[model samples]
Target: MTDYSKELEIAKQAAQKGSEIIRNYTSNQNFNIELKGKNDLVTDADLETEKVILTHIRNVFPEDQIMAEESAGERRVPEARTWLVDPIDGTTNFAHGFPIYCVSVAMWEHGEPKVGVVLEVGRDQLFTAQKGRGARLNGSLIHISRITDPADSLIGTGFPYRDLHMVEHYLDLFEYLMHNTHGVRRPGSAAYDLCCVAAGYFDGFYEYSLNAWDVAAASLIIQEAGGEISDWEGDDNWLFGKRILAGNKVIHDFLLNAVEEHFTPEERKAEK
Candidate 1:
């Protein structure tokens, strides 16, 4: 069995340290921004925060492998423990001085997330989860919203970079959800979106074309907060598949069914 308490402490410390780096850089009057891809962006803050988080993780868990957004070296390390890190979950928002970004850290043991942390830097809100231990925001326990009716629930989602071919399909899904739900929010940060769901700020969240580092940490938070998580197909292996739907139990099944109903044959083939 994994030492989840120790792992959670390490993840919390790493996220807090990374958040400090982000807070310091965000306050600076001038910072450099760069494009990682078409619409995907990076800033000096992202790299600096990654460096700090990796340094801290290595100092305490030197033998563990690392998969990070800014500096991922290899896919597999022939080890039992792997750390997934996203220094800044909402780079575009952070670059534009928006306060919705966060630092996410998760540890995977035997291919499952065992502990996770998502730190909302500007707000100083630290969300954490350990398997079987429950989830917390700041220092208090959190739970998903109890809203059962989709029409009465506020939902959150993300739009992937335009060039990805699924953009149109995603838009269709977004439009459908917008008309069906009370309100829909695109926060540009998957980690923040899931954290919001865990904290009951958003009743549900779904998105396509996300990376493992993007959802690994926040998924644990949602599940531990008495919410449900799954792939677009309503499967549990969301980490590897790059698609996710999360919400409280009452709405999770309903939302998944709605999403499945809209998947065209072509879209299904593309997913495959």
Candidate 2:
């Protein structure tokens, strides 16, 4: 039997601690915040959360690699296992007190996501998943939405803020989805959005310019919940390919074809 109880326990513990820290700082009127990019913002909560979570993980598995959004450096050890963390996803939302952010913890073994936990701090909802086992939301089994028709599906997407240069192209894709799908919602938190997908709240989700921490845990949750994910090229480069498309099998295929029809591989390469 595949037992990931230890990994899940550590992830939940760290995530809970991070959530507590985030909640404590959310009400602070005067907190340190910085701009990491044009629209990217980082706050003291992020740093502190990552510190606590990292410290806890390192204490148990000192030699394992830990790669967090706030901290990039990793401990390169044998086994090539890495813990991916997003202390606070949807920082923009969190800073604005929009209650749309979450803490994500995931461990990738040999570059494959094996375990994941996304804690929606605001709502105290925990979405967890283990490879080949299944996905759960607050201990209840969850699955992706079965909406196959794009026009009848509630699709999720994120606008291009960091790389405005791709805004026009992204807008084109957005326009297509907006017109073709029932409707689109951009929750500003990719991690949380993936959980939404896993819970059948959203039928499909696509975005660009995302980091590993933002999608690592959520992606695995989606997969374990019987969803499909890939890049614009319909490949497995979602981690760093700067693009991601995820949905049920049929919707995933539809989205991939739509992307292929919008931009050719040559056009994409030219832009790069």
Candidate 3:
């Protein structure tokens, strides 16, 4: 097996640098926000942070490909050593000074994630993981919660901001989880929500319409932390599949079954 210690360090460094940029721009209310779609926002902070992260990565691994949120947009997952970056995952939260955003960075080689890092900017909690090494939060080893029952679990999720085609079915699933689980939260950032699952802060998480940069880093962290992640069909296509469900083994299965009961095959196929 190949060692990914150095790549893990690089991901942490890039995420930290990007977090600094996000913090610097947090106090300024006029960071030049624009809309890419009806409810999708892009800000100067997101663009500037992405540039800083990309530059730091390019300086160290100049030949590596990058798919950053503000610059490269979305692309097919390539076989080369590619870095997936989301400079600020929760642009809406940051733009409104809600302070629940993050800087996410991950490297993929041979079509799998090799290293991952996600830094929650508001609290400065850094999560890092390598292919084989266990996941970490601020340098301490972390693992998923052993909560087995959905009724006793706290679930995390995101609302559909850009795409509303599946809103009705999504809300049905949401209401079902609300009545079944201990509680449900929509934290705005999918990356941060997934990391919360990795750190055991959240027992599970699910959402739709998320892009590759949103989950690439956090999904690896979840797996390394002894958790499970997959699309609604329980497949390994969560990265680009537009839907994700994650949790510890038991809670994961519970969520999967809930999804199965709530969503239809036609709705699942619509996302693909």
Candidate 4:
């Protein structure tokens, strides 16, 4: 197997660089924030941090493509060696002075995530993973939670902010989870939410209207940590498909079954 330690190192540095920018802006409270859409936010910190990350990657691997959330906007992930960067994964939380934001960086080779890193800026926690290597949190190996029953599971999720038309369907699922699960939390950052899954904090996570950059890095981390990730259809289309349900082995299957029963094909298509 090809070793991705070098790529993983680069990813960590890139994430740290982006995290520094996020911290600087957050501390100074000087970033210009704007709404990308309803309840969707972007900030100058996001743009500047993305530029810094893209430049850092180019300096080490100039031939690789880059898909940054701010710059790539509605573009498709290229079918090549590419760096996916989400400079600030929780802009709304960050802008509101909440400490749950993070910087996520991942390297993908031909649609496969090779290396992933997420820096939880507030607590200075680092989550890293390579394709074949096990996942880590601050250099210690981590694994997914073994909780199987929804009645005992603590789930994580993101609300459908961009499309209110899908709210009723989402709420239907949410209501079921609320009644069945131990509790549900929306942490405002999908990257961190997935990292929480990899670290075993959240037993599972499901959401719609997520983008490539939001889940790219964390998806690999989840897999390396011995979890599973897929779209609502329980397929590999989660990266670009906008709907994702992720968890450990048993919970993944449980969540997939729940997703299938609650969501319709028409709703999934409309998200795309």
Candidate 5:
């Protein structure tokens, strides 16, 4: 059997170490910044944090494979164990001095996330979850909100910076939700958005075009916190797919139906 408690402890330590490195770099007056794409930003802090995280993970699990945002290596791993690392999930926010970024780390076994950790550096909050175990925030148990009515639920979403064509589809869904739900928020960070849903701060969240490292840790946390997660088609293939929706069971279904209605037959076929 997997020692989930031990794995959680190690992940927590690694995340804390990475958070400290990020915090220190944020105070530097002359930190280097680079643009990976149109709206994707990277900084010295991101690379430094990844170094700290990878070193810690390698020290503990030498043979495990690593899938990280900054690494140029391939993600394929013939072994059963792998680590997903997003040293800084909100690099754009971090570069702009926004406090909504985090260090997300997850361990996968047999192709599923088995251990997850998300450390919000700005707030010093640690969120963790292990397969079969409940989720926690700062060592306190968490659960999804009990809201059932879409009119009273607050939802969250992230827009893809790389693809502008998808923006119209996203906006259509957003417009529908804005009129039906209580409110909607765009936090610009998928990892932080999932953490908020796990903590019951948001009733639901959905987004399109996200990478594995962006949602691997947060998805497990939401699942362990008594929330539901799936792709836009209301399926379980969230890890590899570009679309995701997460919320309490009731709200998740409601959001899924609304999202489906926003896409036309041709749009749906094009997405496929």
Candidate 6:
């Protein structure tokens, strides 16, 4: 078995470095903004933070492949193992100074995420996990909420900002959850949302049209936190299938049932 302590620490430091860069831009508001797509954005913070984080990782593990949002095109090695990075997971939130963005790092050894680290910068919360070592929030062990009943659950989700073709069907699913769960929150960050569910802060989270960089880290953290994660079809293809439903077992299945009913086979596929 691989020892992931060093990997976890490096991922944590990368996130911390990213947090500093994010806070700098948050206060100064002196960054160039780019429209990556309709309603999807990127900022200087995303690029700079990605640079620093990748620099540190390269210094330590030069052989590991990296797939970060801003700089992957500039620096990519053959993939034996890979590092996934979302320098600023909630760019819109960061650009607007909404204070809900984060840095996410995940180490994929072989093909699966072996360690995950996500720091909610504004909140000063660090959520981490190594495969087989239970998930943690700021060094304390965490677990999914045990509320097995659907009606009592608090769910979380994010809208497909880049692709709205399925908006009507997504709304149908959202409306069902709104009337069913205690409440639903679209906090504009998928990494943070997944950690919130892992910490039992929310009972479940589901979303579609997400990049692997957005959920790779948080997915491992959620699993190690005693939570369940899967695609809309209740399968393991979430990373690229573009659909995810995560929570305790009961709540996951409950959400999956709704998703299977609402999203058709074509809608479930990742946007090309």
- Local distance difference test, each candidate: 0.85, 0.87, 0.91, 0.89, 0.86, 0.90
Off by over 4 Å in 5: 72-79, 264-272
* lDDT accuracy of residue 127 in candidate 5: 92
Q: Model 6: per-residue lDDT, tens digit, 180-211?
A: 88988999999999999999999999998887
Off by over 4 Å in 2: 74-79, 264-272
Clashes of each: 0, 0, 0, 0, 0, 0
| Runs with alpha carbons beyond 4 Å of true place in candidate 3 | 270-272
User: How far off is model 5, as Cα RMSD?
Assistant: 1.9
What is candidate 4's TM-score against the reference? Answer: 0.96
Best by TM-score: 3
Best by lDDT: 3
TM-scores of all predicted structures: 0.93, 0.94, 0.97, 0.96, 0.94, 0.96
Clashing pairs in 4: none
Model 6: what TM-score? 0.96
Q: Summarize candidate 2's per-residue lDDT along 1-272 as a digit string, tens digits.
A: 56777888899999999999999998674568899989899999999999999998899989888889997864231257789999999999888889799999999887788899999988999999988889999999999998888889998888878877667666788889878988889989999998898999999888878888899899999999999998888888787667888999988888888777776574343112
Tell me which of candidates 1 and 3 scores higher on lDDT.
3
lDDT at position 73, candidate 3: 54
Superposed model 4: Cα runs more than 4 Å off: 269-272
Q: Please write out the lDDT profile of model 4 over residues 1-272, one tens digit for every residue.
A: 88989889999998899888888987899878898888889889988999999998899999988888988854566668888899999889999999699999998887689999999999999999998889999999999998877799999999877868778778888889899899899989999999999999999999988889999999999999999998887788888888898999788888888877787777765244
What's model 2's lDDT at 170? 68
lDDT of 1 by residue, 1-272 (tens): 44589888989999989888888887774679988788889898899999999999999999988999988766442348899999999999999988689999999888777898999887888999999888999889998999998889998888778447777667777788879888789888899999999999999988877788898899889989999999877777577566788999867887787777776644533132
